[model samples]
Target: MIPAASALARAGHEVLVACVPQLVEEFTSAGLKAVAALPDQAECWAEITDTGHDQVIKVVVGQRLLARGYPELRKVAAWFEPDLVLRDGMEFCGCLVAEQLGIPHVAAPSGAVNTLAPAAIAPLLNERRAEFGLDVQDDPLAIYRYGRIDSLPPRYSFAARGIPRAVAYRQPEASDRCEPLPSWITELDPGKPLVYGAIGVALPTAAASRDGGKASTIPADPVRALAALVGALSELDCTAVVSTGGVSFPRAGVPPHVRLVEHIAQPLLLQTVQLFVTHGGYNSVREAVRAGVPMVVAPLFGDQLDNARKVAELGLGEQATAPSEIAAACRKVLGSSENLARARHAQRELLALPPVDEVARRLALLASAR
Candidate 1:
């Protein structure tokens, strides 16, 4: 969605993104106007349940926040009155407001909203929309559901509850989302496997893990962990693309074979890469799946650990607490011809889904309808 926002702005729309303050700069840096949609509060919690109950709880709380902030949002909207509104999937208030204003709106999922997850939470979402005097039938958006792509399920449970699923947003290889990396990453022999290691943007310290009664950064030793994984992977013939994610890697003893960058074109990087080593953020994991590549999940905080567990349970990827064992695991995944075949096969299956551009086209039509 970040990439798409830039694309929309480039297309000459006056885009005013309503989002958390921490992320406003991302849009502005990309040349779009931004508005802070929510307060900058730090909250983090562990995931003990996967029945979507937590999402329900979040929606309930978000409603209170929306009620409190509606006046401010209205003022901003009144001032901006954008030609279109795009809301991040978890943030429903913007969607509500867009509906009331009859603005062409697009919902972009910042994380995965699987069939299971969405089904469990649709009732609450529909009810919340109703309370805001908005149509629950607003277009559905399924961005970054899995693999670094966006997709909507052909249907959502909201339809069963009388909220017809609107047009969904999806794209397998949205060029606007990722910047291309150097060609050196392509040096790997296609016969030999490749791994892409990444840690996504860290969230503000979650509410539950505040330290000294204040918010603290994530505790994972990401750099050290990546180094360990690289060492383990050295024994294998595969090359590794290690993204530092705005962190600088120590240069003293770095390996030449390892390609290090702050970020890579996610969709493009996923294509040839055989395995993804990630912090298990929803977007990263889902993108990998959407691309059909397998993964090695090293969940650091919040829902990441649970996402990693699900990856392992679903026979889609492996998991480890430390990087020392990553190589052996990678080899295990490679050696199992069926697993390798399955992972690649999944990629092909997902690729068969409609690309994101088609989804965007549908959204434009729906917006016209409104």
Candidate 2:
């Protein structure tokens, strides 16, 4: 979330960022204040069919993005008279425009709202909050009643299996603004073991956001899944790299210890890698648990199969899909030292949270105590 919207615009607050037109210049080049309130990304991922992720996120992605993004986010929250609306976890019209104007709505981090199931999407968002006349919620976490926002911490959470509990923060190892790592990544091999890979950029930017036309319900062909993620990181002996966010593949049988690139800077190359190879996207498993690395997951769908089953149920790695199980789950998480100490104990529980500029001054005194 652009490092908590650049720490709530460096604590002065007033951050906008509604989003959709394939990310309005990634939130106006990360200076914040953005719009395109919704639509385009092949019409907001054509309600991601092939159904059944809590019945396609409660009967089709909260009624197709609340009937195409609730009238420009309720005319941009009734002309920005906002205190809090902060939606992100598959944004359902910023909690019905903060309950049609009562305010305070949180929920930023998302692996589809941390593996769905708030009584299976709260009786379909309480039937769209009683057709937006509000006053409905029987609390399957009344759209999180101001308690959501996480960057993984609950013993390496992917969140749902019973939810409500997120105020964790601190996952910003990189991308408060990206693009830097490619000076031929200092010519690879510091004697092998580097790996990286990336089958993301969310289904080829939602199947090439119809800037071309037709073909969208993203049935995955992301250039043949980036040619089976550069043919399983060219048979991994290490020294990889990958990215391919700019998708294109098949360099005949890619070798020379792989390289690929369509973009890199992945949490600054997972802090000098040693095995990642993801698809288990929940912001790439909270950027490989803020770079303690260790994955090999090959999930290719929403909540990336519950973040590859919480990275092999918290051993921090291993889950594969074909390409010889992604080169044997990248040589079983590069010959596990107990999955590299459970990925450095989920990077010390993502460095014991808090710091996102102290959760943006405790969410601006929780929207100025409403």
lDDT values for all models: 0.60, 0.77
Q: Please, what are the lDDT tens digits per residue for candidate 1 over residues 19-126?
A: 667888877886777778665434322222332436434633355656655556777888887655666655556656666776765556544332224444555656
Candidate 1: residue 265 Cα off by (Å): 4.1
Once model 1 is optimally superposed onto the true structure by TM-score, how far is the C-alpha of residue 84 displaced, in angstroms?
7.6
**TM-score, every prediction:** 0.65, 0.33
TM-score of 2: 0.33
Candidate 1 vs. true structure, TM-score: 0.65
What's model 2's overall lDDT?
0.77
Question: With candidate 2 superimposed using the best TM-score fit, by how many Å does residue 136's alpha carbon deviate from the native?
Answer: 23
Report the C-alpha displacement of residue 264, candidate 1, in angstroms: 4.1
lDDT of 2 at 85: 74
